[model samples]
Target: MDLALTAAGASVRAAAALSPRWGAAVALPLFGHVAPPRPVRVDDEPTMWRARRGRLRIPGIDRRGTEVETYEWGSGGRTVVLAHGWDARASQFAPLVRELVAEGHRVVAFDAPAHGASVGRRTYLVDWLDIFSALQERFGSFEAVVGHSFGGLAALVGVAGGIGAQRVVTVAAPADADALLTQFQAGLGYSDAVSVRMRELFASRYFPGERDPFAWLSSVRRPIPAAVPLLIVHDRGDRLVPFAEAERIAAAHPGARILETSGLGHNRILAADVVLDAVLEHIAAPIAAPAAESSAQVADREVVAAA
Candidate 1:
């Protein structure tokens, strides 16, 4: 993985050095890399197998062409929805889902378009928004929504766009489109000129009326209702997303509370006990405690046996 990323970085730098215009052309696919389907086969958690699964067709430019896979872990109760980051599938939430289920709240998580088992090769911000919209219609307003990285940004955008989740949690997520572009460039070693053109291409291609890609992401800064609470959590040591992004997000939404972690890093934040406990406290949609705990333990043993 390191070698491949290094090669990609070298290629972008070389292309940018030759011609700024052609450099942007080369970077176009990198932007598209954001939406590409990824291969993921990690299935260590047992909770994944115990859940009920369903699929919903996404309404895209081509009606009924895209579909997303959904997983339901518990029955009727205040629900907490989960959204995974780019290149991640829904099952990545197994640990957090089990905790939520143990606490007695229903948990629903879905594979975003082009990720996991969902159909299609491309996904975008709209795909995230639309999936949350569909889930909201079916589950009504969620007790809370937990999203990591790109997924975190989506939840905030969804809230702004009227997909209701009473409580919000964003972990290691970027604050704006510009922040994302800057990080991508820094990692891939793309020139500032190339990043600018890539943004232009993105704006022209997906957002016709908008000239800047950041405009589409402006919803992250839109005013959220005072009634809804948001929590912004990030690890200072994370290499993928800077902690400053979380600060900016918290600053943008005055109602948001900020939490910082130490060595857990980006993806590891999802697995930390402290993070799970913090999330449970914010949502406070507990199930019948002792019974729920026993059932959750049984489910875990079943999962291990099945594995």
Candidate 2:
């Protein structure tokens, strides 16, 4: 979140936090920075689930030394990055994080720039990509990258930028960035002029290259780097992001698979047993190996071939 942008946004955000009525203004200039991340909520896990928690400071990105909050679990070679949705903290993934660790994966999750225990009180959807890029630089290649909602969209941005990843998973991700903007406008009851100016401002802040973020939302036409196994998960009952969005993502990526669950709404999908099982199996599934043969079997096979 860039506090240097506008005072109206900051003041409105502060007011919005106190009263939900002001939340309609979230779309104006400070859409992403409208709210601070909710405080860390610890889950009731076994004592063994202790995480190596800390902050990562990048000199260039955060001039004020705003090291972002980060948490890690497991020490296995296979690393999986977990990205939670908009306005949510990294610890929200505690349930999934434990499961991933138990499945023998080194898991890393973080609160985005201004969220969670990180510095600052503002954030933007575009900054999510930057966070992933910074983490990828420090962590190297990931075995799998998992994202939900807005975070899922950021995962797409990372993939487009060639962040090293073996597999990608998105849960209830938006199909188009333009759609997000429209939703924001409608949510705030803002006019077309506001939407247009906001787009210009957003472009300047994040996509200065004149690149289209909406296109990037579904950017798998060429399958970003030719190919990367993708899993798109969504629930038909989700009210926040529709199930059709997942279908569109699947359609964009030729081989991308879509898994639709039931009754898990938008947020509850993270806790559903079926969703957890699917994600675990996808990332933890091993490559097939040739069957080992005993000397007697080898001899028998050789004899049979000779005969």
Candidate 3:
């Protein structure tokens, strides 16, 4: 009887440990982290036909050795590279592209790997950085970079790594990879241990032999690169990415500007008037002349004064 009681207790403990709630908590975040199926629409052909730009094929950054498709609009001179977000196609930036071109700026846009016409099964951070590098080599340095959502994160990483750009604008960008990953995990009910493990797995698989990518955000302190100026924009009502993430990015980068507006959530913020105006303002600002790395200091002072 004693042996049977002991066996029963052990079984109960095991069952409790494997409860549905626990499983859901761990598995949910992992599952949520997986990219969702891109919606298929019938208008792809029509959209392509209407596109005023031509497509260019370039070798992908990943070892997959696939050719990625990049599209471009407008003629040369003071080029602006517009990078779209996760699960988004380059066509999504069409409105902005038209406006920029009308304002006498050339626009270059690309379909990031695994998105739109780009060739890939999946894409990671390195893929983004690689694409940016390729663009810099092929299309020349950009006067400004405008990115939406995940593209915004990629822009930050690219600019920090010295992709020559005078100004950068991110729309609804998450502050950093960790915070974004945490939110993704929480959405799926993942336990802290599982979340950490998954992050490690991602880091190992996506960035082997490389240091933590999130750390790159903090390394922009002094001796700030003269080529990169950052403008961060977020919607206060964004449910996909919290506004705090923008604030965090602003706090980390010396002269980073944060613009918070109401009504435009994650998706719609791209088209919001306030966001468009702010982007134009940032881009039209005079290019910083070569100085003793004091622009960051001056920008910080201006931000503080405005606040």
Candidate 4:
């Protein structure tokens, strides 16, 4: 465990000793906190420098003005939106941006509120939906929506919720938000009592009217339509989100194609040549014909599992 998580766990435990509600009250904000944003890698520099930079003023958790950094590249072929993972920046999709632009795609990407160059301290799942909604109004229907990790979840949710897209891709993303909260609870070594209250508070605080926040934020329960080709790429050895999540997603979306990789773990899989190739191919493929509306498997599948 890292020093920061260790210290946080200790603090939460102490608060739980006083009262589980107290621990939950303390833990909720930390759970939503977005900080120490990852720096733009040296590899991301070239693509970052080439982007047509812009900004979007979207309402945030506090219903105040928030600026979200946006980037665009290429023109005219087809527009693709790249959604980076949590605590990650738009520039992290540099390699994919280059590839898409090379194929004559007008690529659109953004750093969510509280992430990258965007200005905010806390964010939630709904923020992604809001950003996607805002972008759709500007860019019109997307040719494809590609997302990684939490952003991937947002993409699935967005497309499932009727943000038009012919193709959808999710990389190393969990199937739902509830699993992430469970992982966070485990990592913090908090008790079940604290977890229950924490979830209750989280839903009330973030999504007031929602009867079930977890289900509302789920990708599996509300999957992208079968008509839209969905590609799911996940590392078999990923330590953060287990490969089973990929299987679950694939199982839920009958016609989805799933690619399993080795060694790349969580983040590095983004730049893997195989991953990029698969994404490009999936993007370029014609929308699924009636016959193609079945689980179309791809790449090396050691398990021979139905996608």
Q: Can you give the TM-score per candidate against the true fold? A: 0.83, 0.77, 0.77, 0.94
What are the runs in model 3 whose C-alpha is more than 4 Å off? Answer: 1-62, 217-227, 290-307
Candidate 4, residue 307: Cα displacement in angstroms equals 23
Model 3 poorest ten-residue lDDT run: 298-307
Candidate lDDT scores, in order, read 0.75, 0.68, 0.66, 0.86
Clashing pairs in 1: 103-287, 104-287
List where candidate 1 sits over 4 angstroms from the true fold.
14-18, 34-44, 60-64, 211-213, 285-307
135-169, model 2: which lDDT tens digit per residue? Answer: 78778888988999988877876786778888888
Question: Which is the leading candidate under TM-score?
Answer: 4
- Each candidate's root-mean-square deviation in Å? 9.0, 11.8, 8.4, 3.1
Score candidate 3 by TM-score against the native.
0.77
Between candidates 3 and 4, the one scoring higher on lDDT is 4
Top-lDDT candidate index: 4
What tens-digit string does per-residue lDDT give for candidate 4 at 1-307?
6898899999999999999999998899899888777888987998998999998878887777687899999998488999988888898889899999999999999999889888888897778888888988898899999999999898988898889888999999999988889999999999999999999999989888889978858876887777888889999889988998888788778767888888888998888888888999999998746554445543233222112
Q: Mind sharing the TM-score for model 1?
A: 0.83
lDDT, model 2, position 258: 74
lDDT of 3: 0.66
Q: Tens digit of lDDT per residue, candidate 3, span 1-307?
A: 3463344334433433566344434442232232443553453444444455544444454464665667666677688998888778777776676678778887888777767766565665566777778878877888898988888887887887788888888888876677666765554444565555666655655566767745764323322264567788887788888877777667666566677777767876776666676788899988776546443453332211111
CA lDDT, candidate 4, residue 128: 85
Q: What lDDT is reached at residue 279 by model 2? A: 83
